[model samples]
Target: MKLDILAIGAHPDDVELGCSGTLISEARRGKKVGIVDLTQGELGTRGTVETRYAEAAEAGRIIGVSVRENLKMRDGFFVNDEAHQLQLIRVLRRYRPDIVIGNILEDRHPDHGRAGNLIYDACFLSGLKQIKTAEDDGSEQEKWRPRYLFQYIQDRFYEPDLIVDVSHVWEERMASIKAYTTQFHSPAGTEGDATYISSPEFMEAVIARARLLGKRIGVPFAEGFLSKKNIGISSLDALVLQET
Candidate 1:
């Protein structure tokens, strides 16, 4: 399906933690959105792959995405090699999204940074026409490259080229994150042992990060993104003016 936006994450909840609110706000505005998870998050200490798959589906429904696909790459070992790039390219051709949102360039988790670079390279390669891919039917796939490859800020802070005001979808965004009950922290008891992400503090920090980014635009909450390419705005009125 042709998607307006395709969000990719190294693991199940990466998209939710990074850009789910913005995605939800966009989807609620009638934009077609999709998600591609690079792995099942099997290397994680808490939840199993089976549970992560279920949680991811639940989160996708909450975000109202057109599709939620998993590449099934090794969670912690996936590399940015030719094979991996071709696999990602195939998905890009099939989805043909205008905007591709990827993980943070560099983060606390090494996988996040690797994934960010991997998607960045795959995006360029996908547009090369010569880098061939095929559809499910084994037919030739058209070369497709997303116009914007945005890297969402995750564990580490980086100056963002743009910020998406997601104040309206804050509640729904939190719900989506919470949907990954197995991976995220919950006040209620779960089957697995506690991890860094499973702590109440981490959840609070996530909200705090949104608030911090929102403050830049005088919004209640927002999602920040970094892009190496110049971001074009239609007019000056489109920008958020600073207050004295």
Candidate 2:
């Protein structure tokens, strides 16, 4: 099915942690949104791959996305090569999304940075008619590239070029993030060693980060995004203006 937006992440919960709120809001408006995880997050310290997959599915339901898929690339070793680009291109052409939500251009995790660049390169290559790709059904794919690509902030913070107000759906977004019980702080239970993100403090920080972004725009909660190119605005009234 054609998608309005495809949110991609390096690992299972990356999209949830970064852009799930925005995705949730958009989907509630009846937009066709989906997710593409570059890896199954097999290299994570806590959760098993099987558990991550289950959690990702649950999160997709909570966020109300139409589709959620995994590329099954190597957890920590995937690189931005021709093979990787081709794989991504196939999906891009199949979905033909207008906008793509990608990982931060640079982040604390090396994989995040790599995945961001890989997505950027793939999006461009996917639009090239010369780059041939095929669908799962063996049909030749057409060239497709999203018109806009926005990078979500995670781990370390960067001043966002845009902040999406998610006040109306903040609690629901939290529920979606909480769907990954094995990955994040859970009231239910815990197994194995505690990782950085698995701690309660980390979850609190997540809420705090959203609130901080919201404060910048006088909203209760928000998600921040970065754009390499200047965004176009039709009118000043359409822009969210903060009172000085």
- TM-score for candidate 1, please give it: 0.97
Q: Candidate 2: misplaced stretches above 4 Å? A: 241-244
Compared with the true structure, all predictions reach lDDT values of 0.92, 0.92
Expressed as tens digits, the lDDT of each residue in 159-184 for candidate 1 is 89999889999999999999888777
**Deviation in angstroms for 112 in model 2?**
0.4
| Model 1 stretches astray by more than 4 angstroms | 189-191, 240-244
Cα RMSD (angstroms) for every candidate in the order listed: 1.2, 1.1
Residue 143, candidate 2: alpha-carbon lDDT:
94
lDDT of 2 by residue, 103-139 (tens): 9888899999999999999999999999888977889
Give all TM-scores, in the order shown: 0.97, 0.97
